[model samples]
Target: MKAFLLVGFGGLAGSMCRYATSLLFTRAQSDFAWGTWIANVLGCLLIGLIYGLSEKFQWLTPEWRLFLTTGFCGGYTTFSAFAFENLKLLESGNYWTFSIYSVTSFAIGLLAVAAGVFLTKM
Candidate 1:
């Protein structure tokens, strides 16, 4: 229950932050998805930094980890979590699994989006 609350509240906050940050990059005339691109990159960097810090520092707790990574980063951009997991897989020399994950994630994500768009247009 406590973990759920922590994640929920943290996710809310993280989502708000994502919205605000993305708004900063939004341009009415621009066709590029800069806002999403920037958000994903920033989220990945932040997740990596937080994870590294938690690994190096003994003071960071499990609750904090849940709030920051699973909750905040998860809400901000799931791409960051995917990136983090892929990095871990690569670091551990699980090249086959990493390759599968990377390829499938991209392919499935694009397919899913296209499907959604097609459905919406219908």
Candidate 2:
């Protein structure tokens, strides 16, 4: 489908850009993971903008939304997805659920990555 092609192109470009940015920051000796944080924040903002625009203007093709939000933003930062899911919980007025989701996602995600790294080293 045409939308798939757009998503593919966006994914390719977004991935290459992410790789380049990661290397650029690491090479520049930037302190901390400013690169990741920056990427996440920018991705979040752009996704927000995209979502806003989507709601504001339904005239745009669905392909554009898929390319930018699903492809570019998805490739750029999964943090947007994470944040949005949490927001869904908050929106339901489930503050306790939000806290549980927050702690569990962070803790389990970190642990899982560590476990993966440790296992793959074998």
Candidate 3:
């Protein structure tokens, strides 16, 4: 029960943050779903940091890990939105945008995670 509450609260906070990001990006008037991309990539980076810290310093308890990774990061990242956006781009004949967005998101997301982990080593 305690763990559940922690995860629930973390998810709530993460979801709120993600929504705020979307609102901020919406103001930019760009067709790209920058908010979702940023959120997912940032979430990946954050999870990497959290895991690295956990491994290096034993800082986070299991409960904290669950809250941060499974709850917060899970809520913060938007895989469904990413997939849907890609579908929209494909359907709309924006192959160039779709290809770039899809490739960059994956590549950069992996790099962000690696960077976060590397930062912890230093």
Top TM-score hit:
1
Among these predicted structures, which one has the highest lDDT?
1
Instruction: Write one digit per residue (lDDT tens) for candidate 3, span 21-73.
Output: 77776546678888877877777777778777898999999999889877787
- Which of the two candidates, 1 or 2, achieves a greater lDDT against the reference? 1
Could you tell me which 10 consecutive residues in candidate 1 have the lowest summed lDDT? 51-60
Q: What's the ranking of the predictions by TM-score, best on top?
A: 1, 2, 3
For model 2 the local lDDT of residue 26 reads 56
Q: For residues 41-113, could you state the per-residue lDDT of candidate 2 as single tens digits?
A: 7778888788788889875577888898778877877787688678778989999999999999999999999
lDDT (Cα, tens digit) per residue for candidate 1, span 1-122: 99999899889988998998789997879998888999899999999999999899855699999999989998998889999999999999999999999999999999999999999999
Candidate 1: list runs displaced more than 4 Å: none
lDDT of 1: 0.92
The estimated TM-scores of all candidates read 0.94, 0.79, 0.60
Error of 1 at 18 (Å): 0.6
Of candidates 3 and 2, the better by lDDT: 3
For each candidate, the alpha-carbon lDDT, in order, equals: 0.92, 0.80, 0.81
